[model samples]
Target: MRQNRHITSNVGDGASGAVAAPPARPADQERTNSPGLALGAKAAGLPIAGLAALLSARIVTDELGLAGYALFALITTLPALLPLGDLGAGAALLDAVAADDGSPRARAHTRGTLISGARMLNLAGAAVAATGLVLAGTGTHTWLLGTAATPSAGACVAVAGVLIGCTLPLGLGASALAAIDRYHVALLLQAAGSAAGFGLVVVAAGLDAHAAVYCAGPLAGQCAAGAAALALAARALGMPMLRTVAASVRPGQQGTRIMHLAGPMTVIYTTSALTYGTDRLVLGHTTSAAAVAVYSAGAQLYRPAAALLSSAALPLWGRYVQRRGAGGGTPRGELARLVAWFAGAALVVGGGLVACGPPVADWMLHGEAPVGPGLMAAFGLLILVHAVNHPVGMWLSDAPGLRFQARGAVAMTAVSLALSVPLAIALGPAGPVLASALAFAVCVAVPCHRRAFRHG
Candidate 1:
């Protein structure tokens, strides 16, 4: 049976089938930022921080040339896939701790699970690091990297593997903070880390450091931020990572149950990674590292706007749950309102890309960029499709809804993969974006419209 109540409590994830207990107590509430502050800060922070990271990325691409840019672009994608490293241990850990009711039995169970989960996460990290080692030591570099795969590029890949391994358990610590209602603290640290990492990247690139060092600059920032966050969270939760236990590093029944609950969510993450994150790799293998450079130029423009607009689902989704939960009916016009907001975002972001993209691409890439009207149009449509589709997807909040979302995700993935390679071969950089936009619109968006409007 589905047991973790927080899965539903976190509506942005489209979890359902459980009602949260009332909000935390006053002292408990004081531990985290107020919802207003959290919401408003994200409103301002996401864009600013995204820009900082984008600038750093542009610098990396500019300094690195096509080969370096390809490797850097590929490295940037590692963090997105990090959530999968633990095989659901982190989620299970969050569920176990968040449900704690201050009773001794609950405390013991939470501790054991936390310790075991932490250890599992650590092992998962080491395994990931080993995988990086294998990659570094092997000759199959072209399997994932761009056409400019070099020995140093392999070293950078190993650096990414090590970076991921270190970050995984630290991520667990951040999740622990969230479980205890200290999410804002984690967010603040994250933002600071991004800002700091940008400075570091600029300095290192200016110094003309070696390829591996400069390429791994962002991961270094991540490690520092993660370590700091873990330290703070450990102090708050009184659970030091890897040092607080005599218990065996094995999950008990509770761990198994939480992992089971985490299965569908894992699938959701996997499908998203496959569909949205594989475009660069496809370009690398099917075309050239130069293609990755061109595509990333366009991606840098649209991704921020798409990410910002798509994030609206988090807040809007809660309003739906609150109103519907209170009235025992569908929300009044929330879907329409959200869809309209998304469409507007599409116009501003997508339209701007079409009109101003060429000059901006040239500026960011530090040379004459050859992006055409067709590619810009594809980027616009991709943004519009994702912007509108995200809210509708977030609106589903039940067992069946969850199942439907998973099915849609699977369909979208299949469609994207089926088309991305051949299409990339035919259409160049625009192919994967077009494939994603088409798949999402047809498979996910169409069905979501049926369930969200007419069927309901």
Candidate 2:
């Protein structure tokens, strides 16, 4: 889902979904300068903020021990896997907003329509998640962590579902901010929300709160963050939030078209979720909760580094969309520069992690979660592969290239699933990382890069 913010788009020339070249304009200068600063802010803010959250999580995990930390991880993972929750409407709304060229009144109406539809879809997602949690609680489905389905855990899952449902609409707000080129604000709000959530967890741990109580911290913080973002977006747009919601109930032609773009995106996102998220599910089902803790702990080290790199690349989406709309050709030199930067960053970070990650992991996990050097090295390599591939993937996100990218993603997901099972069983926690790294190289990185370069 974090990747979704930085990738995917529907904005292009109406014909062929490729932007026709446009005459140089003043707005282009603004576009050029603004995105650079925004990207820098995101690159700096996300990792710093993510580190804070990660540290807090480390504290909570240490306090709670392996089983308790696993429960927390399980609660967090549930809402992430519910692909239908937003019904692809947020992505659609982003496209619609980015491409909108209408009178203020007209644009507001379209925004309202899109917002309403997205809200409904998110509500549906929340409902489905809640129902699933209820079923899991009642033993109608397998427990996520293989724990005895206790009444308390069931109650906690229900609460988490409700929180997830509430957060769904907030994603639209963040997307709206991005569409309007308020990327910094969107990123800041996200960072602030994460920090708040981390603080809550840290405080809860300090008080020796139960795992369920600790779980509530993240959900509550997310809700707060979402509300703040929605308020800010509404204020910026000069539209009442309630009126926007009302307007969305009656979608116009544009709203319908947005959904058209969203359909395939939904599938893309679903497969992506399966590809990236299956590791935890596999670990939960096939191994113990403690195994999940160990794997997730090691994996957590990779996330901030990835987030930092991804943030730098994310601004390219807006820039590319603008260029595509102007009918510009691929910026092969710029792409090369980005790829080089990512590759260099990967070498530095991956090398450092390979050298230092074991001690850090041991310290964070407090010996309760054992992360070997081999696991650290594998995780570092995984990060390297993803970093190198991400910019190329983002470059290929325009409509003309989207279908091919989707196919590649599907293939990657299949390979990831196929390999995850054997590797997980054979290698324990590091198995999924190795499997995903291989899948990306074979199914996504190679094909996408080759196609991207050829097209360029």
Candidate 3:
């Protein structure tokens, strides 16, 4: 009788005649999170891409000589500021998209934000390109690097400016793609386009074209590849007509939120640019182009470590946001575990870099350099500090410490100039690292780590 009853229950209910189970969740279909894996893999590729680009630059620089190299960096850097003219839109759009994942609202916002950001960047880039032409026409050629006095040099600057201006819209799209977790596609596009750009530079060099052509090649390729991505994203999101979307969306307050978030970041990035980007420029004033090249080479050797470390933290940060939403406070145990994980990885990776620094430098530079074991050790120590500082500092904005985190960022900025100047003088190229280490140690790590364990 019991078996008969069970069989009847197992049979379809009278209403539908189908035995029903809960719907399969999108997450349940995959044991591991696909997006997370994609992000991690993309993060891993950063080191490889950075290394390849550096090598490509080195090859072109070697072929054209130091004048070619300096001109390339200068031309590239000049246009870089043009792309940044989008203000905080890129960061804002990413935040909005990530916040609204998995809904029609998310789809709408993503499409609208992307279109707005791209258009803004494109216009800005074009304006800058126009300015470059005017400068060239007016004989204000001093800003054109090696072409300062020569007509051909001015022409080269104008061309490079145009290429850079064209790239802004595409670069904006690349950033957007990365934010949407299309990491693999983004990486592929970046690698192929960047490589092609290098080839373009080499070809231009062979023709005895000004080094500006080498600078222009990558920018042109980036813009071209980026257009494809923008199209793909636009289609995927089912974006409405630009006018209709803007009229319907309430992006004003949301835009403000994004600026609030990105403003501090902008400051931090600006300071970092000053700290690091100014290295060659400052050296240029005090030293020879060869010296700048040597410093740049050493700097490049450490670039992989720096980039990978930051990349690895980013997706983990997204997870942090999700977890914070679910809980009242940051789980102390979880925070500790993550911190330890970062520290351990940093130790292993930093030790390896320190061990291999000299050999790697020799290979990259194609000869002996003054970059020695001490410099490597200094680099490793910086990485170690970053490993500890990054997570702890990030966690300050989570859970019970949100206010503290804001205060901490402000404090860090307040003290940055005071902290950085002495360290920069004391350590030369590695001064920023020391300053960063000290900032976290004093402002974030010392306090947060203690508070996290106090409740236990």
**In order, what lDDT does every prediction score?**
0.66, 0.66, 0.54
Ranking by lDDT: 2, 1, 3
Per-residue lDDT of candidate 3, residues 1-456 (tens digit)? 000000111222111122222232342222124335544655656555556557755665676665555555555555433325445455555555444434445444544555555555556676868878887777675543432133355666687668767666655554454444554465566656666676776687679776567667777667667666655544433332223222323334131234454454444444444434444554454445554555555555566576556555544434444445445465677667767877887788678777877666656556634556666666677677667655655544333454454455456544544665555556654554456556645665566666656742
Backbone clashes in model 3, listed as residue pairs: none
Candidate 1 error regions (>4 Å): 1-39, 46-51, 81-120, 173-187, 228-256, 315-332, 397-399, 452-456
Return the lDDT, model 2, position 337: 79
Question: TM-scores of all models?
Answer: 0.78, 0.84, 0.71
Model 2 lDDT tens row, 1-456: 011111122222211122122222344455456556566766667665657656865776678665666677667656556655466666566665555544344354445456555557655755765785786567654455464233446656766777787677666777666665676677777778777878888888778876667777777777787778777776665445434443444535233444454565666778777877778878777776767877777766776666666666655566666566667787877877778888898888888777877777776677876778777777778877878877777667566466676788789889999999888888888888899889878887888788877875
Ranking of models by TM-score: 2, 1, 3
Q: What are the per-residue Cα lDDT tens digits for candidate 1 across 235-257?
A: 66544443432223444312334
Compared with the true structure, the alpha-carbon lDDT of candidate 3 equals 0.54
